[model samples]
Target: MTEPQAYLNGAVIPFSEAKLAVTDLGIVYGAAVTEMVRTFAHRLFMLEEHLDRLFDALEYVCIEPPLAKSELKQICERLVEQNAALLPPEQDLGLTVFITAGHNLPYLGLSELETCRTPTVCVHTFPLAFELW
Candidate 1:
């Protein structure tokens, strides 16, 4: 079978290998937080504003990112670079910030189990499918 063209876990990948606990809080309780931003001319036009909003969402959800702003920015840039070949010249890019609260093992049908938070950070590219201008 062919693997996914792109996948990332703190790095870049061209395979479909990702680990997610079945009882993860993100899966069980559906606890997720994210931010979306668009790109134009191969650049994130309002990166600062998008990041500011992302930080606000983290504050609101109480999830502390492990990396500084610069690091995250690099990741986002990499996503664009990796996916650039799949994009059209006139197409814009989109970025997403998806974080989850690890996993919750409460209903794993076991009483002696505990769940921990496993945060995931993904910087991927998507074409502008929904826009109003």
Candidate 2:
């Protein structure tokens, strides 16, 4: 089987290479927001709604994503399309978007104060297993 691809920051890469630093705020503080959208008939279902909730969560957490709504949507669609080749006819993909509050300076002891740094953006997909349902 071919490896799935993922969007990490600005690049599309293999899912195995989508690594986050151990000190990343999302890992240390859980300072991140995420959304998951599933595909139906190889098309995204309620993409806008999922993004809306993601933005809402980001707003609540004060994290600003570098990409706009339209751009994010485009990326998601592109990724889904790219990974469609690996999906079985009966299976769909679960698309996920995760935005983290960048690096954690406090964790590195670089600063006594904390601030919201550049956000880490990642978009990835996985095969949805209906058998578990």
Candidate 3:
């Protein structure tokens, strides 16, 4: 099977390797806000707006993302290029930004280092599922 491309944090990843811990606060506390960036002719449209919204969500919840928006734009561009071959010349691609606070067990929850206030950003490519029709 062909290796699927994924952008997790700042690295290019295999889709199979885009793994997250089960104990993540995003899962347990639903402490995550997401942004969906649709593509226009295989390029992301209004990416800045989507990014701004994602940041707004984080700020609203008081979670600071480890990576700045500039860093994220760089990653997003890379992900698009890495997966360019898979997308049609005229087709659109879907870029999703998901950031959730990290998880901490009851024992270490009090520590700032282990606190769930820092946001974890995970970016990935997605196909246009048929369900939207």
**Each model's TM-score?**
0.73, 0.90, 0.84
Best by lDDT: 2
Alpha carbon lDDT at 37, candidate 2: 95
Q: CA lDDT, every prediction?
A: 0.64, 0.89, 0.77
Best by TM-score: 2
Question: Model 3 — which ten-residue stretch has the worst lDDT?
Answer: 107-116
> Which ranges of candidate 3 are over 4 A from the true structure?
107-118, 130-132
Per-residue alpha-carbon lDDT of candidate 2 for residues 43-88, written as tens digits (9 for 90 to 100): 9999999999999889998888888999999999999988988877
Global lDDT for candidate 3?
0.77
Q: After superposition, how far is residue 1 of candidate 2 from its true place, in Å?
A: 9.9
Candidate scoring better on TM-score of 1 and 3: 3
Worst 10 residues of 1 by lDDT: 1-10
Looking at model 1, residue 73 earns an lDDT score of 74
RMSD of each: 4.1, 2.6, 2.6
* Model 1 lDDT at residue 123: 58
User: Tens digit of lDDT per residue, candidate 1, span 36-68?
Assistant: 778887777777777778777877888766567
Q: Candidate 1 at residue 39, lDDT?
A: 81
